[model samples]
Target: MSSFLKVLFRNVLNGPSTDPFPLGETFTPDRLRGKVLIDPELCMGCGTCKEVCTAGAIDLSELADGSGFRITVWQNSCCLCASCRHYCPTGAASLIPDWHAAHPEEDKYVRIEQQTVKYEPCSNCGTLMRPIPAKLARKLYASSPELDPEQLRHLCPACRRLRDALKGRPFPVAAAKVPAEAQA
Candidate 1:
């Protein structure tokens, strides 16, 4: 009985052990890994976040803005490993406190979403894509400088592949045959 009374007194004097956050700001430890924030303007959409996320929490989806893409962070799958934050090249991803992240539904987790910038249309199909026109052209023609940049316009992967298929121009399969006399 004495021990029980002591416990009761301690509980009353110490107050509730639960943290009051959101409504009342709560303290966060220095090492605590919190929610993530992504800045669309700074993000290059290089897929570095998706690549480094071990939990597969990051999803980059196609948006209406030409080359612009949408980033979806699945808080449910996120382990708060900070891998995505560290790998982000543009300093677009960062950790922030989400004290009120709790939800009644167990499946629902906190999410940070944004969309990247839209670039000009592709020359071939006139489809808007990534803002870097020169880079996109280089990706399409790495070795061949003969391919015209005006012809390489901004095209999504699907459209680019379709165009390539319709061209029906077979890519070089092997080196040109050397003359038999040259072999000697």
Candidate 2:
């Protein structure tokens, strides 16, 4: 009987404990995983965000130029895993506190946009590579065209190297015998 009275008094004193969420501002701590914001300018079209995202929320599409890429964020699929944010080399992906990303329709959950960039071919090989793929490189070439080779050349440095490496190799070779220890 005493415990019941104490409980009743406590409840009366405390008043309503239910939060009026959505109507009132809720206190959120710092670094709270909320909405993910991708800075297209800083993205390198490397698909690193898509690769690291555990929830498979990010998708990258090749641009029409074949030299650039676009990013699409599926807000519905995002689990706030923060893998994309941690592995982003350019610091392009960030967590913002805007949790009101919910939409009335399912189609409104997807956000897609193409990153703006001035694509330039490699100076030594003519292969197209984002000049400022890295944050430091972006800072350096933020405003100016730093390299040469305006025309799209078939041979790039990496491709040329690969071609040379495969030049002397046989077209096809018989499979080598597997060692006893290596057998599955």
Candidate 3:
């Protein structure tokens, strides 16, 4: 009909309906997140990023020696949600415009970043552990003024639990006291 002809005429006047294939360059859209970047110096292995990651792509590993921690991102599994970047208290994570690493298999696209910081040894048993990040420690102290920052900061969670459970108990628990026998 007349309408169809008019559309055809417009299309004919407009030339090609699609851009040239493959070789034609295209602009990357604004806020296009392609990969995740972590600055090891700023990251404190807080696990905040891991908790917020929707795709479960972020992994945190505490080194056995307790001297530092490792953060790994499985780029192949990442959805580029930027939740990690948003939740990172230290601004350690950010989304980069560059594409993620290309690999033949999902397993091959792993990216690992490591950070080195001395472990806070348990004041009671001397067991070493990665301490809570500085920013988180500050927040914890701010929220509860009654807390002894020194006591809480140095002791591992297990030790803290044990200390809390034994407080004011009559029985002389093995862990509660540094035995006089050993002291001598």
Candidate 4:
């Protein structure tokens, strides 16, 4: 009886070992993974984040009309691994560890981040396939010496292949003329 009372007194004096969360301010530790942020201006909608996301937190979809693309990241589904940030080619995805979100038992916790970008069609086939981010386009143009920005850069893979194949072919008349000229 004496020991029980002493223990109770000690607990009262020392207070609770656990933090008073929800009722009191939640303490966020260092390197807290809070939320994922995607900069619409910087993001190219390349689907790199979507490919790298192991938790399936990031989603990329094209608009039904084929005019643009929509990129979405679900906060609740995210594991806070930051793989999307690392794999992002444009450096658009980032983690903002500012504040810890308050989660309630009854309600669904969700913070959906969405961004949209317009699609650039293929030059020859007019296929709306590539999402040419301005920064990526500029970088490619600057680095590739053989890439002609004005004429060749915009062609799709199929069109470029066809053009190359045609360039390599010799006309039947030219081959025949070569033999006749040699005989003469």
TM-score of 1: 0.50
Listed per candidate, the RMSD to the true structure in angstroms reads 12.5, 12.6, 7.8, 10.9
Best by the lDDT measure: 4
User: How would you order the candidates by TM-score, starting with the best?
Assistant: 2, 4, 3, 1
TM-score of 4: 0.56
Worst 10-residue lDDT window for candidate 4 reads 174-183
Model 1, 101-178: lDDT tens digits are: 666675365344545555555444444455334544566577778665545544444445655665746423221121
Angstrom error of the Cα, residue 37, model 1: value is 0.9
Clashing pairs in 4: none
On the 0 to 100 scale, the lDDT of residue 63 in model 1 is 74
Please write out the lDDT profile of model 4 over residues 1-184, one tens digit for every residue.
9999999999999998888776787677667778899887678776888988989988898889989788989887889899988898888998887666666855454467888877667665565545445666667678766655555546555555655666745333434233234334
Predict model 1's lDDT versus the native: 0.65
The 10-residue segment of model 2 with minimum total lDDT is 171-180
Per-residue lDDT tens digits for candidate 3, residues 43-158, read 76789999999999888887786576778877777899999999998788988777635656555644543344556566665665656655556677887777766567666666
User: lDDT, candidate 4, residue 44?
Assistant: 72
Query: 119, model 1: CA deviation in Å?
Result: 3.0
Candidate 2 per-residue lDDT over residues 1-184, each given as its tens digit:
9999999999999997877787885777787887787886677667888988888888887778686666877777789888888998788888887676656675574453335544566544344656554545545445745422232133343543443466634322221111112232
